[model samples]
Target: MQMEPIAIYLFVSALFILVILKIKTTNSSSKLPPGLWKLPIIGNLHQLAAGGPLIHKVLRDIAKKHGPLVHLQLGHVSTILVSSPEIAKQVMKTHDIVFASRSQPLSAKIISYDSANIGFAPYGDYWRQMRKICVLDLLSTKRVQSFRSLREEEFSGLATLLASHAGSPVNLTQMLHATMLGFTSRAAFGKKYQNQEKFISILCELLKVGTGFNIADFYPSIKWLQDITGLRTKLEKLHLEVDSLLDEIIDDHIADDNNNTSMHEDLVDVLLRVQNDRNYEITRNNIKAVILDMFAAGTDTSATTIDWTMAEMLKNPSALKKAQEEVRRVFSEKGYVDESNFDELKYLRAVIKETLRLHPPAPLLLPRLSRERCVIDGYEIPQKTQVLVNAWTIGRDSRYWEDAECFIAERFLDSSIDFNGNNFEYIPFGAGRRMCPGMSFGLANVELPLALFLYHFDWKLPNGMKHEDLDMSEVYFGVTVRRELNMHVIPIVSKPV
Candidate 1:
């Protein structure tokens, strides 16, 4: 007997509805966290649209109404939004292993070579091995410390350029970006490449694309939506262009090995030696992906930190005065600010800490995914639920901080809070197994450049501007967030070489 076509379609549709109904009825026993009432298909998405600010701000506002650990359902995805330190600790430390996996945004999948890199790779042996290599062999304090000469050399070049524009308002954004790129390039690729500008331009474009808060990430069930949205095609094109550049770079290094040139072994050299070993599964693509991570992680983050600290300092004259005085006093005694007396620059350290508290590099700290159903603070977090720790909101929560929004460098003077992930209330670099491996490298880039600029030059805002008049709007990008507007400052050569 031949089945009618209409009957076949109706039977299939009925099965789909029955499955969805079964899911809603069976799994509804678990007590989910506080959230807006869910509606079928697009649960609670309407609540998000009735917004003033989107993304982190929206989530923060939701937390105020719903509580620290609020649950939200968007399409088929289950989300746990964390906005308080106590709950953040419960998620990041108490059940670290359970929530160790990454959510794997669409942008990360394409750009990170299908989540092979450390930044986006799921929780597994691969992430462990990559992190071990990077932390111990590449970004260990010893390794980062060894590159002090390279950092100083790059700092000298930037200071020279800034000194040339003594009385004129100089472009702080461009100079800071260039210096950071120089540091990252020299550290990772053996030398600052001749085409550094072109490379940086591509990097900026990549970060812009990987913002991680787009439609492609939120709705993953419908494949054609991303296609019709054109995000997939655009990212693929960018990835190919970036891959081509890396191809030439790796080939050049391989050819350099063939020639046996006597040169300092940089990070690429270290990875090549590691890849040659048969003990590890370090593929060529792995080396390239890790290299990409180093460049991306190292460059913009340092620049953004410096930009924010400087802006914050300018806004609060007392902060600028105190920080400058500490650096100057140390310089006056030692004749130059070298790494030897790094311990004495307590105030400068405070300024940087305060800046981080207010403006974390990765504000939301990259969403985590739950591997199994778990109870955190009596709230049931379902398996495969996407988790986001609101680092920005937690940092400013009045419960942990006094005058949370104010830029008070001295706030950290007697406080034990640090960004090393040990302090739950202040986790800018995240915590547990998935914490950033390059924390030391990132901090070194920020500290040295910030020290050099403050020690050498006396800065003035454009056209005799008052500190309070300065605009400090931020633009959140892929891995880090930075000021939206460009900063201009006039440099007076205070301490001569």
Candidate 2:
């Protein structure tokens, strides 16, 4: 029994190896989807890591070499990556219910109140109830339109600020981020809090950590790895900071309601009003979680879309000129850009669509979990498998798009393809029951800001940089992807508001 420490360690390692081998042997009989050769213990993790930080791009490459539906064993997690629209339809449409639930990663559980929020909640009664509340009360077409005045005010403020900096190099990225934050804060909490900037900064950090690529998420059985990596501690601290802010927000809303001093019912007011209802009984944490969902899901995504659209247009000046011309022409009679005239700016809409096609904010969308083992495309997907639908790859597939790699806004002008998830190849917002429910709200935020920027300013690269020299590289941050570098440009007042 008096063994050396090295002997003990070696014995444990041998046992772990045996267990891994046995598991692999057991699954060998099943008809799993095609996958790259994997090693024991770590599985396909090394391949993914080598491919780079952009998991979608790596997955795309793997799919090209392997098959459309690729099975990857990431540590103890069994994952299925769907690259083509055909397979994506099978997983998201044909067997939607079986894979409707979300894969609860460690960071998501921590930041989203143990997956209580609509965006990450498990598929069940609670998720259904939260989604119903969100669609009906918070994100309905009528509710989004009701916030039109707030959107206009925030964007108009941006136009004014940019106008002041006209002819000077302006950090359009920072301005757009601020504008989105102000709009989201007002829409969600009735007024922008003094700590809104802090909130956004912390949120950005959380997004980076919660990308579902954490070591702990891969090896769930090895719980100590979370602490070893300092991920658990970091997530807890972030959760505390975010939770405290949410608590303060809720307390302010409650105080306002009690005094009857609130002018109108914001999202917080609506959540509080239904807190005690028999049919939709929700706790305070639920309310905080939902409101955080609004900020997390609504803000960065719209901002990223607007950012990418501008970047893409700048990259292709011809598209930029066409979009600008349409924006100015359609809004000329109205004297200012508004959502009402957005319909007439067909080229502008096309530009946005093309941007989305090329660079989806959440390229992989949210990962879905399988509730039951099902056969997809003649291959068996085991129960509890995590599914990643590669929207970025599908959008760029030449089979679906003529010039998939190029930013051609005119391609969408006469095409019937849309991003409503019905068209699987163009599912920028995802598909099925788990599809993004805040589409209207998000689009409102994106369209108005983009139109305003186009209408109020003519942009040029700083230092007389050629448009071709613009860096269009993207940086992936958790669920959303955005420009790698902050866009810097000079704004010349085009049509002074």
Candidate 3:
């Protein structure tokens, strides 16, 4: 019996090797883009791993050496790295529909309710319907506007908490995350749900696991590898935990009669109200998936953006002073900051633009899958090839910006460039059909809290450290990136003008 088992294993191993050889033979004929020479079986994974955990930075370095449009055989997967705006435009704009679908990683598939969510759903009618519902019902301009008071209330609590710890070192990272959590909870769940903290913890774990480089994702043909590596088991557990929590929330919403008639209908209420549409029927799992997408995308991205903006300003005091002066000059008379006069805060907006240019929440915007073989910049890209647009590299490209590496807010002062995806050179939110629909909603979350933080307090680095000494090292988590270390700063309440 033991000999029989060994014989079976040997046969399987031989089969796998033959399959890999066949794939290599087939790809050898294709005119793929230029890339570093890769080894058999492992492909360029060793090269990528050698460049460290910061995959975006590693890919940026590789692109600089090889070219902007580089191809790599990552295990069994064919991958494309786009570091230049022109190629990014070609892939995301000129040939957008051809590359509109997302690459479904194993983690995303398991955690996102089998890729049912808007973020990872396959490009089809289901995805289109879900996105439409999200835009029209949840993220519409009017709907986001309705949450203005909720934002103010959450920020007020944050400001009060900051005031209580004025002279002491405060973890701005944690505080900002908490504020966003509270705001998002009320907006999505109709109230500060009791399980909000638990949900946040689960989501954080999901992001960590989902974003981390998974070996199984690269080698999909090795089905048993996931089980051997225990990644599948971990993801299954996470999915169960998240599913249970979401089920409880949805059940509560279904049980609450008042939710149906409430003036301030939250996102859950909207989803529930629309679940039975004959033309676009949505299941309970689908509802949970969309809700998960909202929480995952809505909270972390906004909070991280605010966090990075603060760190960048603290490091560049001149830019910091200019931004503070502008905020105070505009809002000092009103004694509070709100969205009403946000249009006048030009320099502050510029500061935010600069921050995003340097530190996009998703350094490598969500990977796109080519629907069919297409020619990009004269290079033939294969069907189902995974595409990663290095927004971090494109943002800092010297061809676009003058002092590309510096934190200069003035560069955007008179410039017409914006991050709405029209200007391919600076796509913090991505572009094309797969572009984030919650741009306005996310910016609303970021701009208000950031403006309030500046208006109410003068910040100092903890332990008497100089601004230049502050650590701005970043850690990538899931679809977003944030400072590796929580920002510890002392807040000095500004005197009433």
The whole-model lDDT of each prediction reads 0.83, 0.87, 0.89
What is the RMSD, in Å, between candidate 3 and the native fold over all Cα?
6.6
Q: Rank order by lDDT, top first?
A: 3, 2, 1
TM-score of each: 0.91, 0.92, 0.92
Candidate 1 has an lDDT of 0.83
**Which residue runs of candidate 2 sit more than 4 Å off their true CA positions?**
1-30, 258-263
- Candidate No. with top lDDT: 3
Indicate the residue-level lDDT of 217 in model 1: 64
Candidate 1 lDDT at 45 equals 77
Predicted candidate 1 versus true structure: per-residue lDDT over 14-106, tens digit per residue: 999999898987567347888878888778777787763336778888899889988888777889899999998888899999999999778
Q: Model 2, 400-468: lDDT tens per residue? A: 888789999889999898878889999999999999999989988888888988888899999989999
RMSD (Cα, Å) for all candidates, in order, is: 5.1, 5.8, 6.6
lDDT of 2 at 30: 55
Location of the lowest summed lDDT over 10 successive residues in candidate 1: 258-267
Task: State the lDDT at 350 in candidate 3.
Answer: 94
Clashes of each: 0, 0, 0
Residue 199 C-alpha lDDT in model 2 = 79
- Candidate 1: regions farther than 4 A off: 1-30, 38-40, 49-54, 258-263
